[model samples]
Target: MKIKTLIVDDEPHAIEIIETYVGNFPEIELVATCNSAIEAFQILQKDRIDLLFLDIKMPGLLGTELVRTLKNPPKVIFTTAYQDYALEGFDLNAVDYLLKPIPFNRFLKAMEKVFDGYRPINRQIVSVQTDQNKSENFIYLRVDRKTVKINVRDIYWLESLKDYIKVVLADRTLVSKQKISVLAELLPESLFLRIHRSFIVAVDKIDSYHSYAIEILGKELPIGRNYKDACRQRLQN
Candidate 1:
């Protein structure tokens, strides 16, 4: 069953980001987007929305206030720039409270919580595999409006850009909206190494390494002071 979703945010860019992320999930169907709490409240009265991506601060009525008015509210994931509203958002029983400039992976985690409530009876079984069989693994990234699948083996390195990550491939580079930490967690530990706070490199892609830097694709990336010990250990092995 597709989850009927609605996005309510004052900022157009915020709504666009959420919309792009939501589009990647085939299980979710975005119903509408509203710029104000009052506009969203009107839709809630008539439509049966399964999920709501609501922004807390609006001009007139707050997103939290809108939820309070609904006797039978849908599952809500609150999005806001302020951390002060987190306690209040959770007190109202929100599924998740996302801060602005939301990472794609964080948004993905929030959606997973929503899916837990409506788990399918015939869930697909995943086959168990050994570490040696993980070379075929790949991950889907939200690039522009489409989700792009990237093979783990093709990745040369990854560079952190605050809220985004630049994924360096063998032939091309793709900039994705996600935190490097989140991507690091997804990658297989044996094949990838975090060489610095701003960079992660595929172990196999490194041509040479010294005390302070690593050479890959004829370019050098610095090794972070804290990660020097671990980087040396991984590369040496």
Candidate 2:
């Protein structure tokens, strides 16, 4: 099923940019654009939204307080100009946090979260057909309503940005618009390991490992303190 999304911001230009960007992705449906946290509460009362792009600041109510009131909230991607709210935003377990003047590349990465089912790599998707006999370990993703098949074996690493995760593959990277925790759940346990809040690595693709970082495909990924145990165990065994 396509994920339903809402864009909440006080800026018209930022709202327009996000709406246009979301329009390009077939997987995301813009349910409503809320200019204030109060409006978001009203929207929530009516719609069964799957995702939210929320602004940190607003006039009547603060975005942070709005989240606290929700009994069950759709995954949220915080949208704001202020960088100071980053820590508080994550404390509430927001899916992703985006700075203003949003880029298409980054937005596209966020859209990937809607379709990454996080099943086994061998699973068959309606769009990208995989042959079980070929020993090609890959998965097909339903993105923008179009199915694209990706081989897990080709992945160099995974990077997390607030609510988005980028899969660095050999040919091209795929971005899943989701949290690091969600991606960690969906990717295969045997081939992938969470190295940090913003990073994951393909076990076989590691080029080097150091006290502070891991090198993969010439890119270095750091180890988040929250995830160090799993990463260290993976390296040891």
Candidate 3:
């Protein structure tokens, strides 16, 4: 019933603040407080941590790098003094990003997200068969005043239409009044690529690519100049 948690920070004061905040949450149990990423890794190897409060910069291994090494990492709440790492943290699907000096109320808000994300919801589960004919991940979207489950494999591409985004599937399209950037963060980055400012394509759905554009199901999507290099790199390898 308790969420086993770890706090990894180089600063003693930072660790103490997190410890004090953790004490206020009855559902959270602080199992370990590590001063370095190296120590955190060792603890993670032997323990089952439900949540991790990780600091970005450390002496030997940065918190972000340490997280990349894990095959099945726990829900992470990144704590950092600098806002520069926020994008990277989000890309890693972190539970939350806490900027120092962290307020107690802000820390509590982050903990709430951990529960909201990991806790199970009572609903009809949607399924999808992938190219390999195996069942894969599903995402929940709010549509028509209810939460609708959509399989990730069914999504061909996403197009941004100003304030709203069109989720294009094999058979139909669904429109949601959500920012493309926030929606992109919810998707698996390895399976999807932001090929343009207004488009995100499923990498597997891509048929062919050139310097200027990519071909997907007989449609040519122009590769934005700013994203051209990154898109080319992902497509190549």
Q: What is the C-alpha RMSD of each candidate to the true structure, in Å?
A: 8.3, 13.0, 13.6
| lDDT per residue (tens digit) for residues 13-43 in model 2 | 6776676556555556688897998999999
Q: Give the per-residue lDDT of model 1 (tens digit) for 47-92.
A: 9899999999999999999999999999999999999999999999
Cα RMSD (Å) between model 3 and the true structure?
13.6
Q: For candidate 3, lDDT tens digit of each residue in 61-164?
A: 99999999999999999999999999999999998999987654466578668778656633232222333323325554555644456778899999999977
lDDT of each: 0.85, 0.72, 0.81
Candidate 3: clashing pairs of residues: none
Error of 3 at 164 (Å): 53
TM-score of each: 0.58, 0.49, 0.50
Candidate 2's C-alpha runs over 4 A off are 117-237
Pairs in steric clash, model 2: 26-144, 27-144, 95-163, 96-162, 96-163, 110-177, 113-176, 113-177, 118-186, 163-178
Better of 1 and 2 by TM-score: 1
In TM-score terms, candidate 1 sits at: 0.58
Clashing pairs in 1: none
